[model samples]
Target: MTDKSTSAPSSDSVSHRVADTSPESDRGEQPETIHEDRLWCDGGWTARVIKNEDDDGWAVEMIKDGEPEPALVGPWTMGRNKKDPKPLDVSAFNTLVKTASEVLRRHEQQLRAQLHKRVAVDAATGDGQWEITLDIVPDDDEPYALLTAIDAFGEQLAQVQVAASFKLSKASAASWVENGFRRPG
Candidate 1:
């Protein structure tokens, strides 16, 4: 029999072999599973244990598939010997994926909040309250916003394009309604 240590295939080779036989390969998709001492790739995320720049300790970075940057990075535990990092495991990798997914979710929520605004004001016509919303489009060439007015029944009354810098507030919405939905100056 051959010596296992000397004849063992590298993780990269093993990964390719696994992918070649996987169903995804039939459709030209890359294999998404990898388990290594310092690296774990699965479930649309990859967790890598790396050396910390500020200290002698270790850090783990979680990167979503197709993303250029890691979504989360934090300290990692040391192994029993204290000189080497703790080997990555299934549980630890799953936890890292959860935390990284949460980070991405919060980031998306914050971005949506920044780009959308809403205010409710009494209609100048004395008909009823109207919900005014501003949705900003952050285009590189022509950044703008769409100001919309909706009645209490959820029917849209008006929509106008405005500068992206337009501020949405109760007073401003009231002014717009009072001006008969004319484009805000």
Candidate 2:
């Protein structure tokens, strides 16, 4: 019952979509499923996730808002087995949210990896060791990373860039730390 402009796919350009796919990849994003749930968004396009009613096939709807629409509607596959949808609990919801967030993060990572490059380093020698993976910062040539090194007894060691891919092994890293982390020529 929502407007079409807010729920349908734009027709400005052509796109390619596959008919069959692995179960997890669908996420209720089928052409028909898009139309059923009143799945409307912002750009005069809406998608609906059809709910199972009376044992009927799943479906979706995608139409523009407020235009006596029905521009795009089709059949869709069920996302989860109604026979066992795993009861929705606070813990389950929390876990679902966490998983969803991680999925988004991985997607973002893939995008970044496509645009950036990385290198792995493992510098080690007896009595000294360092290990780190470094990143070649995009648009810049400086190599930065999280560096970890320890002297034999696991003494407090120099640490940095834990959030990045910077790595260095023992010998050189120890020397660098001992020398106050001077940029190596």
Candidate 3:
């Protein structure tokens, strides 16, 4: 018996597949937009209603184009028959897009907060407050952090490259400022 999963999709099922529209494609034509009962692709996002492996219920996943993972996945409502998933509609798709976009935005904000930090330290000379900031570059080959000191006039006093593991705390910033903004050992 032929394996249904490995067999070529029938002509009727071809409509559900997204066409190749990448720069390397010979046609270089944009795929026809899809708006089916269980799938949608528009606004650079796709919402798909799928079977939930954890349970008999249904689930929906929203994927942004070019991203390998789904941005959002959650329980899906049941249809009137209670056996099939509720059909995807324009309103539902738009709402899913908004929620998935928000998820991505929040992730970016959290990452930024983790990689960037700031603190204010008083100079020993009592000149003014020094704004000290730490910006981390998370490169895979060579990770590092930049420690910067900015004077009250917003002029950069010094910047030094430090280990990515450098911890920027109040005491550390103060010690660095006391040491004349030298690279921390």
Candidate 4:
């Protein structure tokens, strides 16, 4: 048996029960709470327009998934009368995602090039080529570099320690290879 008396719901209770109760929501579907002015782009990226804290203008921020900070943040276009921000659209969101992804990709490539530099030089043995690699280990206490040489058969020919400041340009690498991979005087 149940009580027959009806009671009014409290304001807090009503607000708590106003959650998204759609079937899609229960099924763990994609997020649907995004307003038309904000978007969750594909590839784990999100773009949002917000009021600029520094001024009375607007700004856009592009954040990647699981990141605490935005990868890209820039000014947003103003609407008519220059008070409101222009609404975000599909075209603009896609473009921002592309640009942000490119920025990340180029940053990674540049870091790789800096930490590990490589050059191919003609082997003085007159048989096969040799590969010269300089790997920089930037330790906080003692930074150093590992200069290595490998023959065509992937056998390590020589390795030595050099200053982390050593620059591995094409001309410098060629000289090293010609000089038998020894520490330059």
Best by TM-score: 1
lDDT of 2 by residue, 1-185 (tens): 32344334334312233344557447854332121123323233444445446465655544444647544444555324432112222333234335444655686788776544432223344444443223333435654544444445545455444333433444445456556645433
lDDT of each: 0.84, 0.42, 0.84, 0.74
RMSD of each: 5.0, 15.7, 5.4, 10.3
Write model 4 residue lDDT over 103-178, tens digit each, in one string. Answer: 8899889988889999888888887688989999989999999999899999999998999999987788778877
Ten-residue region with minimum lDDT total, candidate 2: 83-92
| Candidate 3 lDDT, 1-185, residue by residue in tens | 11245334334332344565777446633434687777888768988888899999989999998899999999999866587777777789899999999999999999999999999999666997888999999999999999999989998989999999999998999999988888999
TM-score of 1: 0.86
C-alpha displacement of 11 in model 3, angstroms? 22
Cα error of candidate 4 at position 120, Å = 3.3
Rank the models by lDDT, top first: 3, 1, 4, 2
Q: Candidate 3, which segments miss by more than 4 Å at Cα?
A: 1-31
Flag the better candidate by lDDT, 2 or 4: 4
Residue 172 in candidate 2, Cα distance off native in Å: 8.5
lDDT string for model 1 (87-142, tens) is 77778888899899999999999999999999999966688888999999999999
Could you tell me the lDDT of residue 2 within candidate 1?
A: 15
Candidate 1: C-alpha lDDT: 0.84
Instruction: Answer with 3 or 4, whichever has the higher TM-score.
Output: 3
TM per model?
Answer: 0.86, 0.26, 0.83, 0.65
